[model samples]
Target: MHQVAPDRSWPLFDVAATRRIEQAAQAALPPFTLMQRAGLATARLALAIAPHARRIWIACGPGNNGGDGLEAATHLAAWGKEAVVTLAGDPAALPADAKRAWERLRQAGLDLAPAPPHDCDLCIDALLGIGAARPLQGGLAAAAQAMAGVGRPVLAIDVPSGLHADTGAGLAVRATHTLALLTLKPGLFTAGGRDAAGQVWFDDLEVPAGPEAPCALLAGPPLAQPRLHASHKGSYGDVAVIGGAPGMAGAALLAASAALHAGAGRVYLAPLDPAAARLAPGLPELMLRDWSSLPLPSLAVACGCGGGTAVADVLPQVLPQAASLVLDADALNAVAAQADLQALLRARSQRSLPTVLTPHPLEAARLLGTSTPAVQADRLAAAQALAARYACVVVLKGSGTVIAAPGQPPAINPTGSARLATGGTGDVLAGWIAALLAHGLPAFEAGQAAVFRHGQLADRWPAGEPLVAGALAARAGG
Candidate 1:
């Protein structure tokens, strides 16, 4: 078993794919072999996590998940540890594999306890695995509550009970460490999965991935490119940032500064507010210009950082003329409000022009004409829909940012932390992506790399020091 980390990319499977893999593995192996492997893996991991614990509480359910718990309890008992096992469902209703496991536990001179111990060093949650589709009730509910109230480490088998293995939706048990068996589920890395499944570990049970294609991918660290000695400033290309109406000049300046720091050959700032130029003395490297003065056709333009209502005036020109474009913030809102701009945006795809849209959940909801809750309910679907609708790459920013393109499987970024919750971070990301685009990266790869690096900065931010947007923008290229 290996721990899941962000150092390398990993394939993510949905519930249907995981079930298919399980079925194929079971058909090829002897009866109950998979369960035995799962149980042994669970027991070994439990020992490794809490070796000194005398009492280990194992909560077993009515399905095969419970059988895995029963098998684990037998091993723990044989190892001279106090294995407290409790069955939350009727023993007579247990499945074939679980019945066999129950018999094995009985043969080991162990019996089910009426209740969990008042205290234990570790708690194993096996009440519901991938099959959990509804809220917990009865003995399962009580078991979940007990595990929560205990305040001890919880090692959940397969998946935390109640979390949707496909969409990462639903309330679930919060596990300190979750051991993903057979395959890694996408839900564990995105949406509520990141919070529900802490310190995720994976054991494939010695089975290889089947013929099924992955539903999504967990984005890894971007590959580093070395700059050549022959390269010059012009080799990187130019980036133009347009936005900053009135009081929100800081937003546009933040984007311009980010592009400058992120290795753009030349960064130009065009503010909607004429007075905004006076406020940007700190970034001397940024070339201040009128929006109409820049050659839009030759530049990678990042529009709508803080354009407010003024951004609507520029989209008509930016949409069709810019060589490549990244529409963010108010630009997205403008397009969501105007059908003509939406049509213009769609025409760019037909012209084979590269475009990327970076929208937070609310912006995405506005573009989709849906509620934020609906968009967040299935982030992957929402992102994919937006990409298909606009015929461009869509970066759905949230707890687990989803990057989707027209014909490719979406990617879930795993690099960021809550420190990014502060203001102007999205503006910083927009500029970072613009820099990558100016450097000649494709829209999808640019979004992936920028989102990964942007989050990695927050992930590596020094503890005790505040992580503000200005600092984040200044560190973008690093």
Candidate 2:
């Protein structure tokens, strides 16, 4: 078993794929071998996490997940530890393998208890696993509440009860550590999963993954490419940032500054508000120019960071002309509002022009003609739908930023924290993606790399210092 971290990429399976893998493994192995492995792994990890604990409460449910708990309790009891077991369902109702496990538990001289021991050091939540399709009730609900109120470390088996293994929805058991058996799930790394499963660990039960493809990938850090000694500034290409109407000119300047710091060969600031030029003195490296003066066909453009209502006017020219484009914030809103611009945006894919759309949940909902709650309900589906609809790369920014492209598996970025909740961070990400695009990376790769880096910055931000957008933009390429 190994702990899940962001240092390496991991395949993320949905409920269907995990079920298939489990079935294949069970067919190839001896009867009850998988459950034995899972139980042993759980017992060992529990010991490792709480070595000195005398009392360990194991909450067992009606399914095989409960059997895993029963098997674990037997081991813990044999090891001279106080194993308190609670069964929420009848032993006779359990499946074949689970019935065998229950018999073993009885043979070990352990009996079911009425409720959790009040003084237990650690609680093992095995009430529900991936099969939790409904809300908690009865004994399961009481156990969940007890575990939550205990304020001690709770180790969950397979998955936290009530969380959708694929969608990451539901108010689930908040486990301090979740041991993913057989396969790593996508939900554990995204949405409410991160909060529900605090520290993720994986044990494949000695079974290899089946031929089934992963639904998504937990993205790792990008590989750093060494710059050639003889390379000049022009080798990186140019970036043009257009937006910043009236009072929001700082948004456009932030994008320009980010591109400059992120290694763009030349950064141009094309502000819609004429008075916005005065703000350029702070970032003198950015070349201030009129939006009409830019040669859109030759530049990588990041449009609509704080463009307000003015961004809609420029989409007609930007959609068809820019060599490559990253449409963000207001630009995404503009496309959602105008059917003609949406058609123009879609046409770019037909012409082999690379385009990426970075939309927060609200912007994504607007584009999909749905509510934010609906989009948030299934972020992977929302991102995939947007990518398919626009025929371009889509970066659905949220708790777990998702990057999806046509015909490619979506990637969930695992490197960010709540520090990135500040305003203008999205603008910074837009510029960072523009820089990568300017450096000649493909649209999907650019989005992935930039989002990874953007979140990584927040993850590594100094503890006491506030993580503001300007500082984040300045450190884009770091």
Candidate 3:
């Protein structure tokens, strides 16, 4: 069993792939061996959670997920713990492995026809797994709901029953602790995954990954640190914010401020709105530069912060010269509309320059020539598709902000909340990521770290504290 952390990435597997892996694991091991391991692990976890409780309710389903619960009941009974196993299925119609587990539980004298004991401390939700593709209704759904209505903790097996393992969608079981078995699931970190599966724990069942490709990654821990004794203002590197045409100066300036606060030694703004040079009254440190005079390929460039229509004409130049770039906001909209500029942006791949594109659902839809619903349906896949098409790192913003590389397993950022839905937050994120890129972080890592930090700042911000876009920028890099 491996505990997921940031420095190490957990390999993700899809439902079909994971089942194949499970079968392969079973091929080498004895019959019902994996189930026994699962049961033992579940019991150990339950004991640790509610040691003094008088009654332990194990809600069993019709599938193998239920069989695992039955096996757990047998073990708990053997250990002299008060185990109550309730089943929602006929005993004769279980899958082969599950049938064997049920037989073993019956042989061990641990099967219950009625509902589990009501006076429970922690209910084990073994009702569903990846197999549940639709909304849970009827007896099982009602039982799961009844368990939820009780103000107690829940230990879900494998996944939170109803959640889609790949997309993290659907009606999900609200679990306090989830035992992620065999392989870490990608769904647990994205979409409704984080909310449904809380305080995740992994037990790979001593199974080897073998020669299979992972579907996603856990996004473990910060790979490196920024605070060093020898670091100086120049040591961290500089970032230049370009965009904020006319009315949207605050957007461009927000990125600049975020970059400055997020460990960039200095931040320069090259605003498209010339009249407002020396604007952003409160941010005295942001030095203004005209779009043409500012040095490119020297410092990191955060472009497209409210660039609007003006960004279209300048991409021909920015795409060629900017060595390290982050494209976001209306700039992506401009390139999506202009084929020549799209080709120019594509040319960045040949230059080997680092460019990151931050696009929300609609912007990503425009770039992909698809609809927003398609993008939202499978955010990781959409982001990966965009990254490969543009030959740049892509940050698909929304629930479960997916950070995808050109051809790699995407990382689903586990942090962030609805509070970040406010406007100008994306601008702040772009600047912070640019700052990380400027400070010598890889494009993908810079994006993931900046996103994690951006959300972390929001998560930790004190109550009554204003979480405005400007304030968000000010909280970056720390």
Candidate 4:
């Protein structure tokens, strides 16, 4: 058994693949061996998590999940712990394994009750596993609700009761700790899974999954690149940020500052409002230029930080001229609102020019012609659709920010926290990605690397100090 963390990459399987693995494991092992292993693992983890607790409530359902709980109850009773079991399903209607487990519990003199025992320190939820598809109802629903409301730590046997293993949808059990059996599901790391399954643990039950392709990947930490002594400033390449129409000049300047701090060789800032501050006084290195003066064909261009309506006028030129482009903020909105711009954006794929689109939920909704809730319902699917529609890498920015590209399995970023929820951080991310693009990384890799670093800044921010956007940009290099 091991704990799940963001330091290493993990293969995420869907419900179908996990079922296949389970079946194969059961066929190879002796009868009830898997359940016994699961039971033992659960008991050990429970004891480890709360060793001093005298009473542990084990909630059992009608399936194999409940069987594991029954087996655990027997072991706990034999070990001198007061294990109280509240069974939600009919004993006669249980599956073969669960029925056998019930017999074992009865033989050990452990009686099953209909309601949870009071004054319990820990609750083990074995009500519903990954097979749950419908709304939680009946006795199982009541038990799950009690467990969630009890305010104590909950140890879920497998995937949370109601969360969809494939899409991370549905009203799921909010477990304090979840033990993923056999394989890790993608839902545990993305969408609503992160909040639902707190402090996730993984125990394969000694069952090795056979050769099956993973459905998604959990993105890990990025490698550090060492600058060579022989390298010059020009070796890093140029990046130009074009946005800041009228009142939103701060947005464009934030991107420029981030690009500079992220190691861009030469950074240029072009504002849609020609009267916008010509120079970023604090950072004298940033060059202020007119949009027409930019050699878009040679530099990596980050557009739409705050382009407003003025960005629409320049998109036609930027779309065709920039060597590599990152369309963000208002630029993404402009593309979503105009079919001509969308056509031009899609045409870049045929020319083999790299492009990345960064959009929050609302911008993504506008682009896809759907509501924000619809886009967030299944973030992976939404991001994948955007990538396919534009034939480019799509970074759907939010919790568990998803990175998707054409013909590639999506990656769920594990870094970042609520500290990034403040304004201007999105602008910082756009500049960070633009810097990586200028460094010549592929669009997908650039998105992942930049996002990883950008979030790492927030994750490692000093506590008690406010995490504003300017400080975040400066710390992108730190």
Candidate 5:
């Protein structure tokens, strides 16, 4: 069994992929080998979590997931812990592996409950797994609700029952900890997975999850390369912030300021309005440049900040030749509306230019021509779709900012807060991403770091103080 953390890279699997791995591992290993390992792991985790508990409630189902629970009950019994089990369906209805486990539990005299285990120390939820076809109902629903009401921790096997293994967006058991057997699921890292499967612990059951198509990913910690003591400003590279149309100059300035603070050697602003030169009083370091005079690919370009409608005109040239690109707000909207621009964005994917798109749900809906509710409902799926369509790294921003690469597993970011809900925050995020790109971080890392840090600032904002966009950007160092 391995551990998963916010700062580490890990594999994420979908239902089909996970099933294939289990099948392949079963075929290669002895019959019941994986089940034994799963049961052992589950038993160990239960004991560790609720060591002094007098009773364990095992909710049995009709599949292999249930068999895993049965096997664990046997272990718990052997260890002298009182085990009570309630069957949702007849034992004869169990699948082959589950049937064997049911027989083992029966032989051990461990199946003792028709009623719920009152005041049990731990509720082992084994009612369903990736194979669940629909929502939990009947005895299963009552049992899940009962488990939740107990106020004790529930340990789920394989997955929280009823959750969509691929999307993590379905009715699920409120498990305090899930011993994900054989493979780590992508759902557990995104959507409702984070809350449904608390503090996920994987066993892998000694099963090898071979190479397959991954639907999403968990990013590892950022690297540990040290900066040279004698490094100069030129070492970090320059960044040019483009997009502040007339009244939205603050957006461009926010991004410029972020890049400057995030270690960019220098920062420039190219505004849609000619008067940006005289407007920014507090920003003495930001040099204003005309769109025509903006530097090319040598500098990372952050486009569409406060762009309003003028972003459409600037994208044609910038798409073909920016050093690196981070598109936000109106720039993303412009690409969504124009087929010509969409083709250019797609071409960037082929060019392998480091491109990132940071779009909240509404902006994402504009890009995909879908409803905002659809995007928000399955954020991981939406982010991955945008990445595949544009062939660029995509940041589907919202409660859980999903970072998806062209052909890599998406990382569901675990940082940020409600404080970032105000305006200008996205602009600050765009700038931070631009700074990372300017400093030569890959498109994937650049987006991940910026989104993570942006939300982190919001999460750690001073309790009594207001957390506006400008102040949020200033806390980038934290």
Candidate 6:
């Protein structure tokens, strides 16, 4: 078993694809071979997690998942550990493979009880696997509930019971560690999977997951590109940030600060509010200018961090003239509400100008004419739909932020945490992407790199340090 991390690329298969792989592998292998491998893998992980434990409680359901538990009990008993089992389903009503496993466990003289024993060092949750169509109820519910409060290390087989293998929804057992069988699941990394599964371990049951089309990819760490020794300030490129109306000048300045720190050759801040400060005392490198004075067609533009309603008026000029653009925050809202702006955004593709859209759940919902819940139910579909409809690279931000581009598979970012939930971090991300675009990366590549680095800063932040937006922006591209 291997731990999942962002340093390596991993293919993420949905439920349907994983099921096909399981069926194909079962057919090719000998009878009970997969079950034996699964049980052995589960037993080995349990021992490794709690080697000093004297008692192991294995909860078994009525399906094939139960069979894997039964197989594990036999091995644990042979290894001189006290392996106790609780059955939530009738033995006679079990599936064929499960029935065989039950007979084998019974023949091995292992103790099996109808209810969970009060005392056990560790709990192995084999109550449910990939297929959980309904909510847990009756004895299964009780077992799952008991596992949650057991105050010990819980090793879940395949997946935590009740979690939707594809969507990562539904109530699930809280496992301290999970062993994924056959293939890695997309749900385990996105949605509720991160909290429910804990540290995910992959066993694959010694079976190869064939070449099925994956729904998404677990994005890997970005490659390092060393700067040339002869580089100068002009060696990068110019970036213009247009936003910050009235009271929100800080938002535009945050983006400008981020662009400057992220290696933009020249950074210009064009605040819509006339009373905005002409210079940042702390970051004097940012050049403040009027919105109309900017040479839009000549430089990479990052628009709408705090533009508010004022951004709508400038979209007509910014959308058509900018050589490469990043439309974020209020600009996304403005485009979603106005058909004229939407048409102009779509027209950029015809001119072969690159554009990127960064929207949180609400902004994305506004663009799609749906609710935030609807957009979050299937983040990949929502992101891809937005990218396809607008003909631009889209970054749908939230837990496991998704980056989708037209004609490419979506990627779920593995970095980042709740520390980035502050107010102006999105603005910082916008400027970071704009800086990369100015440094000569494609829209998709720039978004991917910036988003990854943006989250990495939060992940590496000192534990006691408060992660504010300004600090986050300053820490980018390090």
lDDT of 3 by residue, 181-233 (tens): 88778888777787898878888888877777888876655665648898788
Give lDDT tens digits, candidate 6, residues 1-478. Answer: 7888788878888889988998999899889998998898899999999999999999998798888999998899889889889889889999888888889998998657867878899999999988777999999999999987778888888888888777676789988999888888877776777778888888888777777888888888777757899999788899999999988898998998999999999999999888885545367788888889899987789999999899999899999999899999999999999999999999999898999999998999999999988887788889999999999999999888889999998888888999999999999999999999898899988988898889889999999999999999888788
Task: Let me know the TM-score candidate 3 reaches against the reference structure.
Answer: 0.91
Name the lDDT of candidate 3: 0.84
Reference-based TM-score of each model:
0.98, 0.98, 0.91, 0.96, 0.88, 0.96
Per-residue lDDT of 356 in model 3: 94
Q: Write the per-residue lDDT of candidate 5 for residues 133-185, one digit (tens) a residue.
A: 88899988888888988899999998999887777778799898988887788
Segments in model 5 whose C-alpha atoms lie over 4 Å from true places = 211-215, 244-250, 271-283, 290-292, 349-352, 376-381, 408-424, 452-472
Tens digits of per-residue lDDT, candidate 2, 375-448, equal 98899999999999999999999888999999989999998999999989999999999999999999998999
User: What is residue 450's positional error in candidate 1, in angstroms?
Assistant: 0.8
Q: Which regions in candidate 3 have their CA more than 4 angstroms from the true location?
A: 1-7, 115-119, 225-235, 463-466
- Candidate 6 lDDT (Cα, whole model)? 0.89
Q: Between 4 and 5, whose lDDT is larger?
A: 4
Steric clashes per prediction: 0, 0, 5, 0, 10, 0
lDDT over C-alpha atoms for residue 80 of model 4: 85
- Please report, as a residue range, the 10-residue window in candidate 1 with the lowest summed lDDT: 276-285
- Ten residues in a row with the worst lDDT in model 3? 1-10
Residue 109 of candidate 5: its Cα lDDT? Answer: 79
User: lDDT, candidate 2, residue 384?
Assistant: 98
401 Cα displacement, candidate 1 (Å)? 0.9
Residues 280-360, candidate 4: write the lDDT tens digits.
Answer: 447889988898889999999999998998999999999988999999999999999999999999999999999999999
